[model samples]
Target: MSTTIAPDRPARTGEAVPRATAGAVLGALMRQRLRRDRWQILIWLLCIALLAMFSASAIDQTYGDANARAQLIRLAIADPTIIVLRGLPQGTSLAAVAFFEIYTFLALLAGLMNTFLAVRHSRAEEESGRAELVGSTPAGRLLPTTATVLHAVAVNAALAVVTALGFIAAGLPAYGSFVAGAATAGAGFAFFAVGLLLAQLMNTSRGANGFAAAVVVLAYLVRGIGDAMGTPFGDGTHQRSAWPTWLSPIGWGEQFAPYTGDDWRPLLLQLGLAVLLIAAVFGLQAVRDSGAGLIPERAGRATARPALGGVFGLAWRLQWPTVLGWTIGGALGGLLAGALGTVINSSIADNPALSGIRDAIGRIGGGGSGPLTQLFISAIFSIIGVLAAACAVQTVIRLRQEEASGTAELVMSAPVTRTRWLFSYVAVGVIAVLAVLLAGAIASGLSAVAAGEGASTFGDSFAAAAAQVPVALVYLGVLTLVFVLVPSWTAPVGWAALGLGAFVGIFGGLVKLPEGVRHLSPFADAPVVVGDVDWTGGYWMLGITVVALAGAAALIRRRDFAIG
Candidate 1:
């Protein structure tokens, strides 16, 4: 009966289909963004919040007396270098002093966090071909960008709330704490706009991240210069910043003067800048193709250089620019160490009022019962150690990037063994470590002598730099092993480990973290050269580095190339 002939039916191809609304698409995209970044964003927020809480609590305990806080502010105002590294001294009140010692670092971390978040969702997705796939769907190109902006806004808003609560939990004034949180969010959002705009101009995620980070750093440096040159107020514990401070988003955060001024007007500058940059980013997206960059990459040479003949050579060729950048940073840290070391010593030498402040600064370098000058140099060198370790981490992470991009597969076709390939990158990391430390050592010594310090400080500078070598090497070796065992974890794990270690090591004591937890950071365990010259930690780290590298070399052969 069913076999009876039926009239042909239309294919129904012309029927309208339900299309997702822009708002629905936007929400979905935002959900995806949040899901991917929840852990990372949480970690960043926690760190920022912890910094605020710990600094407020610690400052209240250490400088409880108003006169003591007043002396600290006066010292910071007198030393331009202190002003360069810290914030504008608003007043001598406990809350104001806490703000002075901590705000610049908070702004710095926020700027970096926002820039990386911007690049990760934008250029990184395009590089993986996901952008084109999404573009072909109903979501389209621009909505994804809109979603990204909204995601960033949500994160920054959380940052503002988290930071405020952190301060208030530690007994800071509630209104001023919220004002400080708002200042942090405003500066972070402006940096986010900068990163999104740069993503449109760069050909790759790597280039975009590098340029955006450089801009953030440059803004910090410029603000420091302007603040350092400012005019001190009649109280001798406050300063009016110069014009150059107005040119930096970080500088704008300083203008908030949260505890003292409690002004909301500076927030307007941050919001206005963000609005303008985001508008420009949208305009660029409207005109440009999905996978292309506004600024085209330059052409390569017709023939390979002799240095490109080997795997190690190739790794060096790819990473030298990165190495150079970190080296310059080390030099700057060194210069400050030299220039400020003497100033720090002379100020703290016999001042009973500043003993607590002196102890606070000394704790950063894992303080020693040595000469005041040596303690100051060690503290500055600890900061330099951070730069070197960061360079090492980036070097190891580059291997993962190569594998994910399929470049490692092409290089493997040449009969190179997996272990050798891994080792080649490790060798480059070693050289980078040395280069950064050496630059720091040289700059520190020269600057110290130029600052009228004794020539003997040259030896101290070299020793301090040397003490940091094993600490950096440990990071390189441990992270290289992580790359081999779990390729996808390289970036997140590397950066997270660095941030945690630095926090625990540099500020752990200041924040009164548990002794056991503080001891776990490589930075905290670095050799102390000031007193009796302890090298026990350095020796242990060297052994650990060797073992880790050996483990990585053997295990790398078992895994196949990762898919993503």
Candidate 2:
């Protein structure tokens, strides 16, 4: 009964490979990514350069005058929100303040690009199955990750160079320009590492992306909180209390203090953190199996629940995660708004300069102070709702992707009709959008109540939050139509619509763009409730939304499933 060992079975070595060979393998992978993504690399570099230059030039035009610079400084000193949002410059020069004010936003964009690029090439490709094919060859396990990190570094370096040049061209001091550029690059690298870490932890690329984005948002919030709570350095209040700002990654970047102290230590701290994160990522990868995550994928229901039999149920299933994500984000945004409102109200009572700016904002929003504040909060929430709608639309398009990928076939083979299947996802998306809006409204209402505003004020705020629904629904409809009629390009088209709407609705006024262009955004037609609430626009938006949705349903019904 003794068993003989199989001749084909090789003895286990129980030893790891040489470090030098591992290094070479990683280097090769990095080279592969660089070579493959050169086009995207170039595009990112170009975009960053252009954006930095444009921002610098715009700032120069906006605050070049001494009077304007003085006025801005005065206002910022009085308003904590402005300082927190824009940051503080050391000098009166347009370039100095511009770099200070815009660097955070620019860094955010750069970080986003880096994170997306890193994950898109690494985890995203892995999830999509392309990585398996690549890995089956002579490629090392760590090669792709190494390559992605390298790519991120190269791109960020390019961004830094471009930003530095832009600042120099804008007449900023050379040292300050260097600090600003490096700070931006450093921030990007930090987030790139974060994305890598997330990619390793999440089972899906989408989950990784969402998690990474949530981290970025948290970093921003932390920085904002720190900035809002921080005392002026020279104001003799407490010198030891700079701890909050010191803890934030964004704050660390800001601590480079660009035209001011030009502190280089914070940049070193950021770089150190990035290196640690990358090292952690590698360590985690070493312990985990390829294509597996640190967190195990949870087992979903094998048998569909009775409630999942219909269109509505399917819709809920598909859209719930996205709806929840947006709801959380909106609530956080509302909280931020509430905090800012508190700051603004206090600032208005104390500083004439802030009061003037507040009055100006009020006029733009259409008059009364209270109404103006409500309108401002509403506008912000509306934007959040629109983002939620975009998420919903993407969720719908996910169904199309599933169909294309043949996953839908499995579901369709079950006791589900095409109409029910499609409607289920559509209904979920719509409900998710509404949920996000409601969450935002509730958050704002709570904030208003906390701020000692009247119950009517809470009602007004919630109403404004609700008002965004129709506009968001219109976008959802457009996406649904696209998802039904032309599934291939639905994502790009849907995202583009959201981007265009945001640009036209939010920035158009600031840029003094034409009314017709502004009106193209669904939000443009939304009534301003600064002084008074107008129900007419709400009715119109509702009607338009209904029409668009109906049109989408009709189109979806008429079209055959292209994948099937």
Candidate 3:
């Protein structure tokens, strides 16, 4: 017991120990990161492949014959909204149609996957103190950053290979498949670099993620507008050239027109932009001190306001940034919906090529004055409703996070009861969801009017946006039930429900699923406000949400608080 132990130190002999090379240090860090992130990487790769393959598989069934394929190309080229949502279709070939149908969205998915991955491996590790632990040893200063960039590269490369093979398996030409996959991967690489640069620039991981997500949203908006600008709407006789598409990195993939133009030049542009971003990331990283951001964080107020004394107000303060982010995104999405809604009629009015799509909307809406516009708005609102649910779920889940972090104990130890504390956050979440939905409605209404639609259309847009609130509440209710019943499964179950609902709602039409099966989605059951509103369905949904929240409150009072 009296024996003294000495720290492991280098020998005092005249000889110096050889230092580990940067490669060796980086290699070890990469190995550790791979082990930690292997499953996440696999799932991301699988999702990318599956999304691509699913989109490709639907092309044949959607357009059965050469004439159908030709019509699709014509309708797509004539519609600025189509080009805005999807990329420009360069040719009338089946390959071109498939590429156009899937690439824009797939590129978006790839970009998001890369962003999350880069942030997790770079800023999140630093935030959690893991990076410092690793750096305490013989590791070099740039090892962590280098490892993260390499991990992103490797994952994106795998995504490219998988996407190419998926296209080939779907019977696309090898050359086209390779080029499209490369373009997709190139888009991801550029965003991955963006995430890395943001990580160095923002003071917190949350800030980094928010900033990066904002950039992604901005890119999508710019590309959508630019693509919309590329075409003159009406009879498609007058064409206008626009440069915003060239300015957006996300727009570069569409410009490739993989199967049609087989243009490889856009890939070079993507790579060049990525290379410059990566270079800037390193330069920025080198100058910033460890655990500090390039931009200094501002100090907070020295005193809390009276409103902050209550749990409800505190919850709002903490979740406001997230709410703001979603609000901005929803506003932008609404703008797109409004712009498209305004032009939807002219785009499909006289085109025989678009008759089938028009007819489908007619069938879905039971044939009204503007059934197609209603269908489009309903679809947009459906997706937005799901996103609102997601945002609400994140907000409510902050309760569990607070509990796990031991902050809830401190708050509850005050005069607040468990019920008040729990419902306070839930109330804030409900308010946030409502605000976001309303914001989207207002933005859509204004944008539609601005886009030259009648001012009355704003009322329709607002009604459509508001009508989806019940469905979003349904999601909130379901997730709250999960949080109360099975705390650990809250995130997975909540997100899975949203994902499954969206998949069913979107793909049900493409796959020609049974009407009964399609109606299982809350969004499907919810009435589109463009026609008569289904008050019965909305009321039932609201009732269910109220019941779930009541039950959750009761349960929170009985159960022991969870800890990490």
Candidate 4:
């Protein structure tokens, strides 16, 4: 009893031990992430490839003839909006010019994917406590960061390869095809590096994501402004200026010009900047503690107020920031649309080629004239509103999150009925959605009025924008039903539902998809104002909302709370 057992000791070395190389660490991390999330990654990549191929084939068929190409070029030069939205490349080849027009948007989407993935791997893991376990092993400090970068590199590589193959298969020149693909991948990599730097600086995942997204929005704005200024309409002829485009990363990528000038120097600058960003990440890692960031997290309130006693109040408090953000964002988007609409109406009168572009927008907007164009713009704005409503639904499901974390049990034990608690959050979501839609309507209306449009014009635009709310509510109801029935899988299901709706709403008309599939999107039934207001679709949308909400409520009543 007096004798003490000797404790087992870790192995000690007299000489310095060689750690794993950065590349080895990076490779292992990339493989692990790929193995864990292969399905999601594969699906995302496949979607991108399919869309690119579809776009390439469509352009080939649409503008294959010499006369068609000439018409398109002439029309593009005449409309400032067309040129800003889709750049005019100096190429006679239909495929090359099409690549130039679409590459900017594609590259932006690719960048978003890379940035989000990188942040999820590097920062989100640490926030969730998974990184601590990984770090406790023989892993070096730089290993996780290296792995994130390597994974991003692999994704970019795959994107580039797939895009290049799609273009080549679509019968484009090999050199130009490869150049376009590489430019997109290069831009994505640059943003991936930028995201890492943001992740290192911010404590919360939301903050990091918001910062990165803001940067992307800024890049797009810079490109738009530059393009607009460079080709201002004076005497019905197009002129190009270089200064504005020089300041934008997107513009830098575009300067490669796909098939036109085929410039390759700009890509080297992108790569160099990425390298500098990586070095900065390493320096940040050396200075900061594990599981923490350069920016300190604010100290939350030590005590909860009586108003925070219920689920609805708590939901509002948690979701208010995101709701405000989307509301502000949607309002700004509406204002921009109004401004653009005025420009289009004014500019189209003087230009003949520009006339065809309006016809195209009208067709997509369900084929009407003046008022219908405004309705089409309103529909686009409504999509943004739908997204905001989806965010609200997700916030309401944070109730489940709270329950799983053991906080809900304590609150429930303090004498609260489940129905009242659930409805509270639902009520808050309803209010938030209405507030956001109203904000958007007001902003768009003000913009229209400022542009010398009639007050009645504002009323019509506001009505069209608000009409999509019922469709959005139906989506929210469906998501809520999923949460009640299968809580564990609700997040993915909800996100997939939103993604499917977006695909159908945006691309169904563009591609020759089946009518049944397109009809499944709630947005497909949304009212579009061609010449006059269409109230028929509004009734159908309202009916769908009622059915979805009733189904969700019924499901919730039947199901027991799935919590510990």
Candidate 5:
């Protein structure tokens, strides 16, 4: 009976069978992703941790007296623009002021970290054809997305732990430190979900990243505008609008108000939103085809226009949206700076602690300008300059993307010379950086006028913004050289360079680094426009930029372009 084949037995179908369960596949993918992304995770965690600690420690170092701390808090609370930029002032304690000044920015940084992390592991993998390979195996369709999101969760969890430890080590209250770290992590997780959803919606990683970044910017602006427009009729209390804080994830985390009082409730909202978004991601992935997005891509012109025949025009066409986004962000930052500038002076002067802090910052670079002016301009423009440098590096890195996507080979196969092609993109990066800087200046100038600085002071605001351009150009040059020489390492090396420069430039005085090391930042050497104009330093930086460009142009002609 056993030897004879059973009459009811069916033949095998010969279809491929899965050998692993969903959990098994997910675990494998998670491990693989962690190994690949460990460096990025480490960098983001270290940056946020360092920033939190530094800000806290600096406040403790600068304002040891209780009365001066209270005075500084009162001044900060009274400034609507400051409230808008930094989120609502927390408690009157020095720790709360530190939280008020830096929590929003920390949230912003976390959002960025999550955005890049999620996009790279999801849409980027799909775009590069790795997702399809994984799909062909025992892995279920949702496994990859699930694994990526979980990886983000793990990374953010680590960020929270490290940040809490950093704050505590910096002498902040332990409970508030923990809450602040958790809030920051919550914001990051929310953006991580947003980025994942965006990856499913936008076909290309670049578009997904840009859209996600725009959301971060929009979140900040919405929170700012809401805080600034607080109802006048809400009694005599300093209670500004609290509703707007609920409208954004960043706001939700920031309004948790660490160190002031722990408001743990708003974090529930962030968690809920993240849950909703992650649920949507699974639904969208189930319906959409691999390597495709839920949102349909628009078809382009059937034939190339006359302007598109040139390298410059093509470069602009590809990167114009990126340029526009950075310009708008820079302009908004400048507007906040100018509006705050109008009030920050009297506020600082009235507070001894603030005045001393300002004077010390002034002494860092030869004490030529009024301390208040130097403090305001340096603080504002330095941030704008760092952001501009980021935009510049991104713009330059597009060259690498083109090469990897085979677009460079096609364009080079045409009658164009490599030198011309390379220069066109380099020119675009240079022009884009300058455009963003100018836009920031003009916007700041206009805001200054609106804030009663008068039309004459508009020129001063413009100079203040323009003075930051040399540092941005230095970043652009560094990135371009990296792209041409070590194409594989462009992003990490380029961004790391910019990050280090910004770190040293911003906190060098507070951290008490050697003067020579402090001046190593290109921005540090550039004259604070609120003080004196160092034409010699400016010319030197410009010359260095030129030299970098010359080297990149020469190198690209000889090296083989990378292909996917």
Candidate 6:
């Protein structure tokens, strides 16, 4: 027999093997990541940049006079609620005011973007068994992580440049725009390291993502609290953050003080933290087994519970922890709404100039009453609606995950109809939406009463919560339909839609977006519970939800189970 040698194979198996260089491997991996994430990255970058540009222009238009900007600053300094919701007041300069109005939000988005990037490349790949496959090649384990880090750095660099250009395009000082960009990129890199380390620790991609996202949110809230507690100085338009702000990456971003102080030292703090975390990640990667996390998955029950007996029960079991987390977040928003609404109302009573702030909030929340308390409740609950909508979106995404992981095939192997399987998850989504809204309503009502409000506040709380229900249902139903029609686009499309809807619905009024465009957001159509209350929007949303859900049911039966 004649032996044929393959050109791509080694001349002899027992002889030395020719492996690719580490630099070549790293470049290949980074190129793969960029190609995979190009569209996602583009969307994120565009949204963030538009936010900066629009916010700068909005501030310029609304607070044209320095006196007006100063008054706005003084009001924010006095109202802890505003400070907690906005950002630390730097100064009354047009540039400073723009940075103060928008930087925190920018940093929050950047952090989320980076963390998701990290988790997706690390734990998610490992979970899909791709990491092990890569490990068996010249790329190996540590080199892949190194590539991820490099990819993150390059992405953040692009993010920084675009962000700076966005502000500069809005006619802010060029130098200060660059500084703001640095702040955003710095915070993002820090969060990226946090996600990388968590990926090394958590047993599953879902667990890592949930934990990382929670950490990002917690950092933002902590920074907000510190800013709200800050002491005003420098003509009462500048305030230094309290000590608690130092504890968060988002807080570190704020300390950059772009357009006012323009401090660059804070970048060092962010870089240092990233270095430490990245070092720890590399250490863990070297020591731990491939395709396994440092933390072990808990052993499952030897016998399944009664709740595992049916599809709906199994769906709830898998999803309740996520639902509970969102419910708690809604409850917290309610708690803040009730407690802070009273304090702000009293402040507004003493300072009539603050009524503009109240009015703007009312408009963002749709038509509402004149009382500052009522307007504040409307605004906060509008946010809670976003939370409930997010829960609904995630539920639909979970169904896609099950199908992609090949688990749906196993489930379908049992005596279960596809429509029934679809309905089971849909039912759980409905329950989760209701649970979040109900928790918020109850918490808001109790806190309002505790704050010495009248019994009627309960009516207001439930009404606001009820108005949000239709909005949440619309998101659930429509996104479920999307999932059924385009299973692969489910996660990306769902999150992007949510993010766009939230920005348009919550900040559209602030930016003076066109009325027709604003009305497209479900949040803008939420029912107003106050004087001459209109339930028309809610009724319309309910109709849409029903139609969408029915369509999803019809379509879900037509698709094959996906395993990707």
Instruction: State how far residue 248 of model 5 sits from its true place (Å).
Output: 1.7
Give lDDT tens digits, candidate 1, residues 274-364: 9999999988987888878999989999999998999989999999989999999999888988888887777766675556656666687
lDDT of 6 by residue, 211-232 (tens): 8889988998999999988898
The residue-level lDDT of candidate 5 at 368 comes to 46
Q: What is each predicted model's overall lDDT from 0 to 1?
A: 0.86, 0.66, 0.72, 0.66, 0.75, 0.86
- Which of the two candidates, 3 or 5, achieves a greater TM-score against the reference? 5
Off by over 4 Å in 6: 1-20
Model 6, TM vs. native: 0.93
Give lDDT tens digits, candidate 2, residues 499-526.
Answer: 4465446544432345676677776666
Error of 3 at 63 (Å): 0.8
For model 3, state the Cα shift of residue 40 in Å.
Answer: 3.3
When summed lDDT is taken over every stretch of 10 residues in candidate 5, the lowest stretch is 6-15
Estimate, for each residue in 164-212, the C-alpha lDDT of model 3 and write its tens digit. 8888877788899988899899898998888888888887766787788
Ranking by TM-score: 6, 1, 5, 4, 3, 2
Clashing pairs in 2: 30-147, 311-424, 315-424, 371-530
Query: What does each candidate score in C-alpha RMSD?
Result: 5.4, 6.4, 5.1, 5.3, 6.1, 3.5
Clash numbers, per candidate = 0, 4, 0, 1, 0, 0
Best by TM-score: 6
Local lDDT at 57 for model 5:
75
Off by over 4 Å in 3: 1-28, 231-241, 335-343, 346-357, 360-373, 396-423, 446-459, 478-504, 507-522, 530-564
